[model samples]
Every structure is written in structure tokens, then in C-alpha cells.
Target: MKPPQLTPAALAQIRTLGSVLRVSLEPGGGCGTAYAFALAAQPGDLTHDLGSVTLALSPEVARVLTGARLDYGARLKPPRFRVLAHPNTPHRCACNRSFGVPFPGRVTPECRAYQPMLWNLPECP
Candidate 1:
């Protein structure tokens, strides 16, 4: 399969992650050798210190993730990332365990509590 295209925004975020985290596509064990995108975080790394998001796709699903865009937003109710699939492509859970549902475009502020704070950076001292 061809390499997946990364959006400018996604590329910027991925680059900001530095070498602390890696995003790659690997072979899946189930459903006809699917493509899986993993967000592997290194121990004590701040790249994913906040939280990590993974996206695994079956061969059937890769088509859906290709050229897709992921954006982060803030909301008052509940917090979550917004995954926008290309037109005509159905969205699925990153785990491949279930179908994805439409979530709010803005993530709730409450979710920020779960993320590690930049203030905790050891270099702050």
C-alpha cells in the first residue's frame, strides 16, 4: 500500500511530539492483515505526557483513515478529539473493537484534568 498522507496540522503536531513518540503503520494480526497506526510513548516522555491517541485500521478501514484529518477542540460538556474522515469513508474506533460515533467537535475542559501539565516539567526549576 502507498504511504498515507498527513495533513499539515497533523504533521506539525507529530513533529512537535519530537522523538519521544512515534506514529507508524504496522501489520495487523486480524482481518486480512490490517494497517495499524500506533502512538507509542516513551517512558517519562512529555511528548505524550498529556495523553496518547492510537488509530488501528483493518485493510478495509485504511481507506477510511487515508487523507483524514484529526483536530483538537475545547467544549464545556465533555472533552474529546474530533476525527474527521474523508467524504464517503465511514469512521471506526481506533481500537477496531467497535464502530465510532459522532462526538462533539470541541473537547470538554474537564478532560484537561487528565492530561499532564506542562508546569510539571522538571526543567521548570
Candidate 2:
């Protein structure tokens, strides 16, 4: 599968964060599942070279992230990263933190708190 594409704005933010961008899967209790993104100091076997930056992903993470796109929206208050065309995630909880991959699960209180912050997020096509 093709590696995720990062926008120039996202690249700039990632560059400031660290040399390597790591993508991993977070397994929740029961059938819940989520994706996590972080900055690493170095690259590993799962890393993808993106010219200016390296995006690291485990084999499992890469499979689920196929066709995903990352971008940054500076205009949004507080400024944040956005995901576009996330084919693997069919339903994201109102929180925007956890997603219903293949199926939806119970919503946690923490997720509910983030519901108000979910506006303007681009939906999966």
C-alpha cells in the first residue's frame, strides 16, 4: 500500500516536532481502536522517507493507514492537524480522537468532552 501523503503545512509542523514521524495503532478495550501519531528521534524499519521528513509506521499501522492524508489548518483556532480521506475509519466518535474502524463502540466520557471541538473536520469519502 502507498504511504500516507503529508501536506506542506503538516510537513512544516512535523519538522519542528522531530526528525521522524511515527504512526501507530492504539488498541482499545473490546473492539475499540484508534491511530496515534508522534514524533520520534530516529527512523526504523517501518519508516518512510518523505524527502524532508521520515514517516515511521509499523506493518500493521501501514495497512490501516493506506490512502490516509495529513494536513494542518492554521486558521483553525488553536491550530491542529487534520486527516483527510481516511478510508479505514468509517465512523469517528464525536470526540474526533477515537474512531469506529469497521464498527462503532461505546463512547467514553473523555470522548464526549471533545464533541464540541469536532467541528470543521473533513469527513471520509
Candidate 3:
């Protein structure tokens, strides 16, 4: 299968910064988490190397990003990489910094198996 592709604009942005794109997950809001990308100089365990900029992502994030096109757009003050033609069709927040989880099932084994101590901890701001 062909690897996921990043647009020329996106490539240029990454190259301008001279760093690999590190793809990972971050808290969106409430209990949801969203895909995140940052600039890094080194590749992580799960990495997809492009000619100029490498993509370092977790296996799960990579799975969700399969066949997606990465592009740069002007939604916010600074243009940012946006995933286009994603299979899951996730919902995005007003600010575009966060997105809804695409998983259909409401719960996961990780949540189901959360330790009691975690539940007793104080809420985070």
C-alpha cells in the first residue's frame, strides 16, 4: 500500500523548521483526546520517514491516519497541518486545536480497567 502523503506546503513548513513531525495524542476536552503533531529532530519507535521530514507516530495514531492527506491551512493565526480525507470523519472544535474521538464504542478496555485510585484523585484543571 502507498504511504500517507503530506502536501508540498506541509513539507515546506516542516523543512523550514528543520525538524521531523512527531505525531501523538493530546487531551482534547473532557474525556476526549485528539491527534497532535509537533516538530522533532529524531524519530521515535513508530515512524514514517518522508524524504525531507520524518513522521513519528504511535501505532494507533498511524492506524487512524492511514490514507489521510496532510495539508497546511489558515484556520488560525498561523497556518497548521490539517488532516484531510480522514476515514473516521472526526468532529473538530471551534478553535481547531482539539477534535472529538472517532472511536464508535463509548468505552475502552483501558477506561474499563482504570484503577480505583485514579477515580479518587482530584479533578485536573
Highest lDDT model number = 2
Clashes of each: 3, 0, 0
lDDT (10s digit) by residue, model 3, range 1-125:
23468888878888887758776655553334456777862333377678767877654466556687887775655667777656543554444444454333331223322222111212222
Give a tens-digit lDDT track for model 2, residues 1-120. Answer: 688899888899888877677876564523355666777723333777888898888655676677989887788776876676677665566555566443223324343222322222
Q: What is the lDDT of residue 9 in candidate 2?
A: 88
Residues 1-125 of candidate 1: C-alpha lDDT, one tens digit per residue: 23234444554454455422233223232221222333454333222232333333333333434565554233513432334444322333344322222112322223211222122212211
lDDT of 3: 0.57
The TM-score that candidate 2 achieves is 0.65
Among these predicted structures, which one has the highest TM-score?
Answer: 2
**TM-score leaderboard ranking:** 2, 3, 1
The lDDT of each candidate is: 0.33, 0.63, 0.57
Q: What CA RMSD would you report for each candidate?
A: 16.2, 8.8, 8.4
Give the C-alpha lDDT of model 1: 0.33
Positional deviation of residue 46's Cα in model 2 after best superposition, in angstroms: 1.6
